[model samples]
Target: MTNADKKILKRLKKEDKKALTELYDSYWEILFLSSYNILKEREVCEEIIQDVFIDLWHNRAKLQIKISLKAYLYACTRYKVFAQIRKQKAIKVELFDDLKKRFQYTNPETKMMDKELVYQIEKTISTLPKKCRIVYKLSRNRQMSHKEIAEKLSISTKTVENHIGNALRVLKKSLGYTFSILFL
Candidate 1:
């Protein structure tokens, strides 16, 4: 850690509210930008930054300081972004299911076909190797870039790309006929 970081940590450890406020003032913009880049939502990014400081305040005693404070704060923001994305994805899935049910009431035949398509997709996903499944889900479902997936999974970016490629190949092969109808 840098000398400035050491001083900030020392002051924070002593429960100096002015030190904490100064730290936030100094780093808030950078942290906000980082969170906004990852989350792409203004309000959510603001909330994540707020949560990061809250977490730092709550867990200051347990925090270790082997790395630069900026790096630590960036990591915390990244994790919060991922958590927010996951929550949003879960909500989207629920909303999609609800829409499907509503659509079913209007068109039984279309609903049946939609159900079959979802089943086929699920079966194809189930056939993927474990790591491929995870990489594919993170890329497609969570809308994460290869670098983000790599960081989250603690794998190399190249490895994340390769897994995503393999998963896509398998999916294309399994669903080629159906995909042709949809695309072509």
Candidate 2:
């Protein structure tokens, strides 16, 4: 979180409407677009974003931002998306395996492409700065909040956020598309 983010958060904790509005304005489109891209359901994505904001405002008093606000909102939106997926009665292991088999057999070309893409992502991650790679891995693989990462590493949250931001920028440039879909 930047100093401005911290100030807004502090104001939000005090139940300031303007702070909430600022947060909502800054993040609404980002939340909507990311959720929509993954879920492919515009109405549900909009609802999810709205629900996230409502929850954020309602729980502002007790909020412990272990991540940047944007990251936190993204996590919340992701959880809601997965929750909706689960609610649709999709068995995780079976559904994933089924999807993989469907893709692998139906399109050998696509399967090869997928493999190459995964390899490229792995290679890119490996080339990141040591601390940036660590931060990225912790956030994506361990699902740790930035605050938790900072605390565990005895660093500031801003450093963790910076590392993540830098890593994402690098990955985005390397991938030539939306890297946030897989990580971030």
Per-residue alpha-carbon lDDT of candidate 2 for residues 116-177, written as tens digits (9 for 90 to 100): 55566678889998999999999977879999999999999999999999998887666433
Clash pairs (backbone) in predicted model 2: 66-147
Which portions of model 2 miss their true places by more than 4 Å? 90-184
TM-score of each: 0.49, 0.51
Instruction: Pull out the clashing pairs in model 1.
Output: none
Model 1 per-residue lDDT tens digits across residues 120-139: 56688789899989998898
Query: Model 1 reaches what TM-score against the true structure?
Result: 0.49
lDDT value for model 2: 0.71
Candidates' lDDT values, in order?
A: 0.67, 0.71
Badly placed stretches (over 4 Å) of model 1 are 90-184
